[model samples]
Target: MSERFLTHQVENQPPSLLPYDAFSTDLPLREALAREGGGWAQAQVQAYGVLAGGEMMALGVQANENRPTFKPVDHYGHRIDEVEFHPAYHRLMELGTQHGVSGFAWRHADSEGAHVARAALMYLHYQADQGTSCPLTMTYACVPALQQAPELARDWLPRIVSTDYDGSHRLAWLKAGNTIGMGMTEKQGGSDVRSNTTRATPIGDGLYELVGHKWFFSAPMCDAFLVLAQAEAGLTCFLLPRFAPDGSLNAVRIQRLKNKLGDWSNASSEVEFQGAVAWRVGDEGRGVATILQMVALTRQDCLIGSAALMRQALVQAWHHVRHRRAFGRTLSEQPLMRNVIADLALESEAATALTFRVARAIDAGAFDEGEAALARVITALGKYWVCKRATPFVNEAQECLGGIGYVEDSPLPRLLRQAPLNSIWEGSGNIQCLDVLRALQREPACRAAYFRELLAARGGHVLLDAEILRLETLLGGDPTQLEGQSRLLAERMTLALQAALLIRHGDAAIADSFCQSRLGHQHGLAFGTLPAAAPTAHLLERAWPA
Candidate 1:
């Protein structure tokens, strides 16, 4: 018994590091907020810090850690398309909503950097739990579309801003706070929402009856959904409520919940609307344009989401290596492991900088057309680049822990699964890259804005200077030639912007290393490939103070 009990004793392992003061420990984030004039958002940061660093995160994550179950019929066998969540999911939703993770920025619409502050909040909360952020993201995204219709906006804005998280599937009119879902992709046309087969026939007074199937209807139990369906004019935007104005259930049929590879906390379903009552959001045929208002907001969240994942993964790695020993020495003491940790830290910092920068632009974009255009482009490129980097970054971080990291019980596995969701959501990597090219080609103002951002750091660093030249060359070449190579160009543009930001705001050594390894190609392939001279210990401490 003694020998067996001794065998059960654990060896070196990482301590459970709760995410503490995500806003404070993240120096890059702090600096970015200061630049955006949101340095005063310390209160919000502290609030999130307490929640993320405590049992809230553990309970919230564990609640939905088990995938949601699709409930097609109620106890009495009446047809009811609903999704059941763990109590943890509801609490997280309540907490997130209470804190304006969805509406705080919009509510304080006059603030100098409301959007930046919101971005920061999202980044912190997502690090705590990834799946529950889905509805919060959709709720935030849906506001602009609602505003397109004064009548609708006047009616819904109050509810949208409500911090109360009402999960019941009832008339939104009766709820204190109502969450919204979205359905843009259909089976036949995924991203090409314009090709949707769902049809909307005008009933009366700008309202219509929609009949079509949505390939992916996320957060099915939401109070309402912003959906796209073909009307006589073309693909049009519509708001389909779970209950009619008279409190009758709408004819939305939930087919089945998707068996997704990850993002288990939230429910995503295949749904159909049979003459479902819906009111037009914008004008008929303005579906894509209107939905894009939502898409752009969600895209920024994707950037933040990816950064959160990266940050959490980095923290876990740093925490593990600090305690775990190998070869008679702590892993953090190992030279190669140090390099890998530093590289990951660099990536996380770059992502954070880009996310907040774009958020600042979005806030300014409200009044400045040029800045708004720039935000449009920055978000897409940032989303594509940061999200694409997240999977690999977290993967390497996971590998740092070896076998335990691969197990489902560890946070690393959940993070690894959550990493790709951002890259693939809103738009896929290819779609984002192509969209960036589209923005450049179609919106000259955006292109000019993009150039201005790059030129701000022109001559500060040799690597940035060359990367800027390469970006210009890509733009100057034939459109047809570059269109197929847009991903290549998007990658260059993303790196160039990150390099510039680092040069302007990051530490001299970190910026120098970032440019040298990322821009100058002075490093070898993979995570541990930072040059031997790189200050690995300093990087680790910067990532999370000792």
Candidate 2:
């Protein structure tokens, strides 16, 4: 790609209004897409653009008389951006009942709403640039419907999975594939799959009927669904197709689309099923495990998608700091401004490094029990931290922009509203922290092994010494003696473990060095200790001794 394409200034306008011709020679994106099997980058960009356009539409950009048709009203009456058009929203919705209620339910009520809105806007920009339809959209929508009704899975799965459809006027907007949209939410349950009240009973001839009301049917209008129902065996997953084999409405009915905080372009519906035709997705009682497959994928995607947005926000902030001036100098020249930038850069890089490390682990086929559990915990941490940091970083960037940052025209304002959703999406920070603790407590040996491996990867002696010293200072040299005062100590230890894992597994050596060096600097400031010989020793050990 040309230098211009690689660092092109994105306009604040809705993507549909942009000229696609300018992106024709964008080699970098093309190369990236090619690396991911020729069409991946294009699809990612397209999905991003559609997501962005959807957000713009919700923001009244293309509305008649410049007034939005659907105001931001969530199920709880909070004002938010339209969130339905977001791919993440659909992604989660499609998983339906297969996912655990605790994490998935919280995601729907909190973060998924914003993700959908932002993803819609991002996809809009991508589609405009790529001049192509997003394949993931419809597929994302259909999976949920398929999951709810297995009979529809056979028919709809082929239509949406993998992009071979030849139909004209194709549902370009509906780009996802056929996978069960697991509908695990229940009206009486409190975001816990174990607490589901809906029931499914076996009637003969390979057919099971379902009766339940799902409160958050994210993409209820999709082709199929995976609905969760309680049976004598335990909580079970059932596939519910939206239409019969002849393409008519099945027993499912839309109760209503939710009013939400953000991403309102698409629908987050509440639905009712009266004996909906469905089939089981795996074993009858193993719904949690089966659905977790989809949930894990979605959670990882949430990290990537949110990180992508954070990258965008960071770039936007960088541009502002470099160009926007105040008090006779550029904002980037100010000491306080530089500090803010530095802080955000460190946070962004750490989050990105952790995300990629987890992705690579998944790619390497390292999903053993220990690895899978750790990945989930790390994913949750990454999501929470990235999402948590992004909003403030954007806000700080906006602060640099002063009044302009607060305006609708400024990207920072939108980013500020959009970024917070990430921390809440997939799972809340508290929930993730608890999961990390649970993993550490429940599988102490696994956790210790994982930590030991991380230490070895970072040069065991050095990491161990560094961590011990850091902890000693925090715990005042004795953990047992500081039991009541160990919360902060525990938190630091967790962060240290997280940082070590990322450093040992990340792709870029220079980046890792920079991170470690930065951490060393912080440690020196906090503990008043300098590693006089460690850096040289570490470098020498990794290099050939001459």
Candidate 3:
């Protein structure tokens, strides 16, 4: 019956790629986890990987399909600002919290490489959905900022680290767990918090009434937000909760939710604080300093998130090519397609290695001063380079699947939309480059740490060694010219570090290919530009084993 009715058969089309283990299948992530001192968390990460590739994958689609809706008022016209999400989003949040994606590092603070292990978990989850990562990342990053004010930490930190998901619209203290968000940028000042006009007046007892507007109020449904406002002493940091201490709705007016290009499942809003109640989180007039730690942690997440997206996109393209046939052979067997896939794999592996290495530095920062410095400078540059590369990386992956990848049903379009977000979210590329420069200039130890990392693999490859020398010569040049060259410096620094890590820990073929193509500039600008001598077959297998 089907033979007579059918106009064409789907013979060459690839089957769905879900229900696989995102962790076990990802050779780079698996290797990086153990290499970066997250070996102790292998079992936990493996279990979560199953769900990330299975249920969470489906949930991601459902959440995105049914975007969050803003309810600015109750049915009776009571101004009860609430954002409603599909059930899938709540379930995803529940799984994320239950699996310790947001709290693992804090819960295991005493453990060695706790941050690295947590980074691995978050990376896996980000492969499932980028939108959910916002609230989770803020919750994870807020711990250090909250600790700046012991009183606030004592009250909020417990709920933040709790492995419970309380999505109910209520006071945070009334819920078993909590999520935090950020309210920093205004229309007048995007990254420069000093230009903020929001005013905070002290009423009494370390409390302030804030009257200002936030241009980007992230995760409006979050239980609380870390906001920056101008106090009597100047710019200050405050804890603005959903409910005021008097057990009533705060004066936070939800102006409207942003119509974003991506992150469909998350709700970012423009908000107005009309005498909104808040508590100072850190010392007066030190808003930037207080939140800098949180920003740093979030920046680390940005890199990890970008790397995760790259991984998933590569996996999708690899899966498609291996199944879809063209020109009398599977697409994966074609020489040009092989180069593109292998090159994509090399980039993905390099990103994973660099990101996890930074995560280890973050973990070691607790006890090692050099590692702390390395985490500081490398995070900014890594975030800059990795996030900047994601959009192009994902687009290359989409091209592997041709027209189908551009459609909404395929994940490539969604991934491409998400790729540029991390770069823009915490701070744009220029801001990240300037941050790297600031660290290098103000912190001598940071410069030392950066060189130490580069020198570790100095003899690993000649191209890498030459690149390192070039960086040294460039850095030694006129200081006044450094700002103009900051982006170049950031890109080179990241590539050098990635090359070093690969030489030290990655497969020989991958290391050689990366050095020759990326550092030595032997390859062209596009994805399929690896040298003809490169081992494309072996690279693809290592990237995602058959």
Candidate 4:
């Protein structure tokens, strides 16, 4: 008898389907964009989708896998204090800025669907890579703050909005296009930016000399940064450059790079400013006002980013489970697996619906105060709820893949690690919840605008109506009592808004199931506890067509 007997090893797996058009295949995204604004700048969105699905996806993987390295000194023993990255990282940066992912809305502000279309493109790009988005997002948001000082903006707006990705570390004016970073949080003061101790002494005119350390200096290689520091007029906003106007390197020293839980492809540093060259952006005591517009824009991107992460996780799970089989049946045929997938799909759709709607509101708000007020509340609301849901949603999706999902090689691990970042990036859950309360308490007109939204879907569904009634009391409650209930209020408000959108535009199956499980409380706390009324098969099929 032969001692070596061969056992059959099966390779039943889903082949890599990268380079597919993420835009065309994503059903909910297409519908949401069309409904929000019909004449979207579609060519760019489609092109980004192509890159996101194909070569860009691969580049994202390679970049993150080979994390950037810090170089304190170059070959000549000079103190360059640089962060070296793989060529793949540079390629991803070029791809993003080249396609106007960072500056599309600013450059095309007149386009009716500019905000919505940019949101769509950003949604696609987030699925490809999370790390590269840091600098890109900051660059886009910095536009609004820069507008606070038009004279200062005149010198840099053209460079900021340029679609080219000039990765050179030269002066901002010397580059074809420039990237911007931010430094608000110091070691002692985190989200408490009001307590920032970075000192800024006036150097004549609006210029200042900054001497302080930023706990988190994001995208260390960027040509410029929008920073917060203490000035003679209290906390103020300043623009700190990497190189002086005369082309010599500024006094920005990279103390060290953070070994983060995720976002490996990007470099975040602890930076020290020893009399760095700076220019004040706005009035001395009005730094907070200038920061608000930029932060609001960034927070909206956080909502969109979470939605994209959820979608990416679902796609990975759907592909793996549909192909792999055990117990003489494909995993998709399993009842419990089917329920989980359907539930995940529903949450993702709900998030997508709200994200695009708010983007439409933000675009509309340019000329309407009521719309602007509405955007303020909804943006904070969506940011909190969507970011909170992302981690759990991605975790369940990863579980659907079993042991293979836990491995480093699988994309799930990366998605899993990246999931919590958005929740913390612009602001944590508490910050977002409190901000919603701030909207309701300080801005009655904003509350009224939100109420108008709630009333639009009145009598359309009993669950929605009941939830709206509850939200009314919360919104009108005393400010002191409301702070303790911020989380609960935010969850209810966000769900109510999502339910309204689903009922108006989503399929009957998704809408009915969401109301039953979320509002009616027909099931337990965990997912997959869907009530019998759920159109499970239809939901799964719609979420991932054959």
Q: Kindly list the per-residue Cα lDDT of model 1 for residues 354-421, writing each as its tens digit.
A: 99999989999999998898898999999999999999999999999899899987888989888898
TM-score of each: 0.97, 0.64, 0.99, 0.97
- What RMSD value applies to candidate 1? 1.4
lDDT of 2 by residue, 1-546 (tens): 778668657543222322222123222222223332224234434544343434422332222112112333568975332323333333323322122111222123232222222232222332221101112332343343345446545545544443232222113224333323447677776457778887888876655778877887754444456667876688877766665434444666665566655433335567777777666666677777666656554555555555555554555555566666678887667766655554455454455555555553433323346555556556555555555555666666567667766887655555566566556544566655565555555666545544554555465335434765565455345434544543343345545655665455443442354345444453333111223322332322222112
Segments in model 4 whose C-alpha atoms lie over 4 Å from true places: 1-5
| Ranking, lDDT, top scorer first | 3, 4, 1, 2
C-alpha lDDT of residue 515 in model 4: 87
Winning model by lDDT: 3
* All candidates in order of TM-score, best leading: 3, 1, 4, 2
Per-residue lDDT of candidate 3, residues 1-546 (tens digit) = 768888886678998898999989988888888888989989999999999999999999999999999999999999999999999999999999999889999999999978998999899999999899999999999998999999889999999999999999998998999999999999999998899999999999888999999999999999999999999899999999999998899999999999999999999999999999999988999999999889989999999999999999999999999999988999988999999999999999899999999999999998999999999999998899999999999999999999999999899999999999999999999999998998998999999999999899888899999998898898878889999889988999999999998898846788898999998888999989999999888888987876
| Comparison by TM-score, 3 against 4, better one | 3
Candidate 4: what lDDT? 0.88
User: Best candidate per TM-score, number?
Assistant: 3
Roughly what TM-score does model 4 have, to 2 decimal places? 0.97
Clashing residue pairs in candidate 4 are 19-53, 19-54
Of the two candidates 2 and 3, the one with more favorable TM-score, higher being better, is 3
Tens digit of lDDT per residue, candidate 4, span 336-442? 88888888888899999999989999999998899999999999999999999999999999899888899987889999999999999888999999998888888
